[model samples]
Target: MTAVEEKLQLPRIYKQTVKMALYDLCIVGAGMMGSAAARHASEKSGVKVCLIGPQEPKIREIVSGNEVFGTHYDEGRIMRATATSPLWADLAKRSEERYRELENLSGVQFYHEIGALTVGTRYGQFIGRTKSSLKGGPKGYDNVEILAAKELNDKFPYLTFADNDEGIMEKSRAGYINPRKMVMAQIVVAVNQGCDVIRDIVLNIEKLQGVYKLTTERGKIIWTKKVLLATNAFTGMHQLLKNPVSYKAMPQTVTLAAVSENTAKRLSQMPVVLYEGKGGESWSKTYPRDSSDNIQFYLLPPIKYPDGKYYIKIGHSDDILKGSLELTDIRKWYSGKGDEELEEELFKLLDTIFHGVRFENHHGDACATMVTPGKQPYIDLLSPTLAVALGGNGYAAKSSDEIGRIAADLILTSKWTYDIPKENFKVKFHVPSKL
Candidate 1:
């Protein structure tokens, strides 16, 4: 047998005890970080990893001749940048390769190589800095470039901005990941590697002498000698940290609508655009989505001008977005009623690009932004048995898999082999008075 077969046939960590099964590592939340870590750890190394999430990632539909998850529709957080730590950067590069390998191994196409652009009306815009980071360099990343307004328009005729506008361009090194499909693909890889993934919500983790007892909502018990808290966005596992990484979960809502194929074609012809509007107006959550049956997705500016650089738009709770901040669900994105002024502004936004349309505001009303007060990712050994990972507000999709891999390395080997400072991984926030 070949080395690959030999590895595959090799038995996993757990022999299945009567009271609780054992795993090399038990991960919570099967989203971007957790799923990638499980898949990468299982395939690249012999780590027997287990992932448990509230929902199972559906993969067969996207591949294997069945559209189970629907017509390749996927929209989620954007992954950008090359990575700050060498360990992370290299892992990110490998993850891109791994994404292809996953296609080769599973016969599914989950990634698009379209380069991303971050348009800034002025300096101090961190998204532009993030685009430059993905370019990869010492003076700055070589893969990234600063595009003058003229060059920007020439490269992407669909995009227009103020004459003084500056943009950060990463040539093909960055692109959006179909977040939902990406999650499914990674979990598929993990399960194929002899790892067991059960669908259940982890309610609590109790330290038992040297081991951890994990209780699930299904009443199933799982025991692991080690645990990795890979849950991001919103899962209160931060309390489990001996050195709990800190990230503020700023709930946000995005207004999504689908236009005709013509509109999509026009927008698709344009490179992914992020216009930080002039007059202090800014658009943080908008992108030309070319990968789904859901038409296009966008987050319009709250006001004609963003009085501040970045601000979270908020509103009352609803079904999917109970704590929604989306203006599309109730307020009109086109001209209408009490919000006519805001509606007209958004209509002009579309008029600048496409024609003809239908709209569906599919996602839940509430979306969450995992913000790090210091603007960085937090990776650390929270305890001897617990490891924590979060805060990818910058470009998590481009970085999470690799970050997750480093996190696994740190957890399994007991040290941060990379050169990133201790402060880079831990947050020193003031303890709350009335918790």
Candidate 2:
């Protein structure tokens, strides 16, 4: 034992091991946008990046502990970038490519090809408008196919359609992506690529002499040469951005219910389905169940919201978010109370699809923020070292990498040029009644 122990001593150091200093860039809020931005910023600019967010913090901690619930957290259902703009199509395709590449990069499964179907009445004006307005090929929307009701029903026999109904059936070019897993994958990639992902909540930002200093809730001050504020829904992140209006920050509540696969089967065959029908609200979307076999609840996108009466959220224009609402402060939407009447509306929708499912499996609710200040997202510069790229609302997932690309380019080149054609920020709802 003595001889073996003596031979197993620590190796002598040949040279001093140097510790690197603080990063060149710091990304606040490690949700989808932040994580994705951090990865690209580091890779493109070759600058060390520091990612700050709560990762499974103790339950009482103020940051992510109350929000991000470890691997149990998720970003609901995702759609392939199907916008009628070439800029949107290119951005979406890039996001989709990265999602697929993450599997090999992180050895974690991050995408599912459940696919999507947009349904509406054949003779309905909404359907006709969708086909026509989406025509003449917006930059990124040239490859999409438009289908009539019979063809849609034939391919997806699981769904019922009226005779005069029409459909758009897309293939691998579009499908379902697991938002949470994709986020985790980006986090892992950033870590492996030599980015520092710190576990802390940023309290404030102070600029001294052109360098950015970030103060954390724990009272630690970190300095970085450049800063990218990628907080998705955290209110604090919005205020930090040079331009608040560009964030157009708003909060929306959504529901996630667990119904047996048998029930999901009878509703819609595809993973993601949207209702743009004449008078129909986006009722339901079904993704193949997660590892837990629970389908996700995407609920409302940005255009979907309560009347915005006050601090807390209320009302929904559609059935999907309405019926399956889980009551909790996942995103801190409250005045210290649960809106039972709102819960009842959500229950009505859940009851329609999942007739007898028990609420025992109803995981507590969660929330995230949307930033679509304008029709086209602006990646502009208010200062030399500071840049802002936000306002996608819930649609950020489709264009996040490009968002990061533009943000990073602006910071590195001191130029505010858009990598993707910016959608015009109309200050109007992006969708009718919201998806």
Candidate 3:
């Protein structure tokens, strides 16, 4: 039989496994990271890999039994190489380099290289760390332009900024990515590389003698030698991790402003903006309400959503609702509109930034971001056979490809192969306090 035919027949064999199909590596959670790791791991010769996760739900109101959700269901996510942390900068730069190659190979288009404008106070901590991260960054990353307040207004008249706010413009390899399409592209490449795609949520995982037996919500049994848990915010919901990873699943809300096609066309040249600090005297009063509520937010240019309409999406850099939500409350949280007060504030902020812009209507939605204590993803092994790649902290969507590659390398070789320190990605467990 031809190699193509052989590859096509493998899934049939896997599905017929009343004996429990065995795979070399099984990755749970087929979101951005999981899909990317599946593609990378499947590239290894003679290795059998499978990616297991549920497809996006059709209804947002109800999440059935064991049905999980992902944060990448949106149309646009910001992509920028200039970050406050050097580690995220490296990961984003590396992933940005592969955007075109992945696009060409998978025949999928997900990246839009319009540019990115980051605004902050003249000597703000965020802007300072962003500048320091560029000290020895990759080539072409140093081609950023510093713009004064007047210059910022002149360049992007559609945006409004405080007089004290300075701007850093990354003209190359920066913009927004359609995360849903990116995940689709990654899974396409993975399947083409001989990986089986299982559309089911992993209900439970029990370690067998030398392998792990994964039980799916649909009752399919999968046995794999090594498992990678890329479960992100839903990590606490799964029984896969023996010692729970130390992470907070905080609630996030985003407001989408729908605009006419003409408005979208007029603002087509608008770059993604990350604004730090107050908007103005009136705007400042409504924002930065407490220590947890920083006056920092980001917005994407008009992007077409699945509904054949265009919207300008905006959200705060951190959680709008405070505190880590209980894992049990996740499904209900997804069903309802996130914090009504924050949604109102977001619309007010949107109107303030875009002063005279016309909008048809606006609405809010809810999602969660997995935050680690150190503000970095935990990409370490839990045991000799089980590994993890959780904790996006609101920055994983853009750098997911490289993060997935690192996760694949760790599992395939059983060692840290990346240049960055493994200690930086060390996994921490949560120990509940006894009353």
Clashes of each: 16, 22, 0
What tens-digit string does per-residue lDDT give for candidate 1 at 1-435? 334333433333212223346777888766677777777667646566777665522332223322111111234333344433444444467667667776566444456666656665556343344443453342466667678778876776644455667677656645655665576666666777866776666767887778778887668788887887776644443344433344555443343333444545444423454544341122222322222211122322111111222211112111122232232222121111223233333444444433233332222232344556666676777666677666655346656677777777777776778655656766433452111
lDDT for 75 in candidate 1 is: 49
Which portions of model 1 show Cα errors greater than 4 Å?
1-20, 44-46, 56-76, 82-97, 122-146, 237-245, 277-365, 427-435
For candidate 2, what's the RMSD? 10.9
lDDT of each residue in 41-100, candidate 2, tens digit only: 767646787777765433323443354332214434456555434455556767776666
Superposed Cα deviation of residue 5, candidate 2 (Å): 35
Query: Over the stretch 76-185, how does candidate 3's per-residue lDDT look in tens digits?
Result: 99999888988888899999999999988777788999999988877887677877777554244466888888999889887778788888899889999989889878
Q: Which regions in candidate 3 have their CA more than 4 angstroms from the true location?
A: 1-20, 63-66, 136-142, 281-284, 290-294, 431-435
Judge candidate 2 at residue 30 and give its lDDT. Answer: 72
Candidate with maximal lDDT: 3
Native-to-model Cα distance after best TM-score fit, residue 85 in candidate 1, in Å = 12
Weakest 10 consecutive residues, lDDT, candidate 1? 304-313
CA lDDT, candidate 1, residue 277: 31
The TM-score values for the models, in the order shown, are: 0.67, 0.69, 0.92
Which of candidates 1 and 2 reaches a greater lDDT?
1
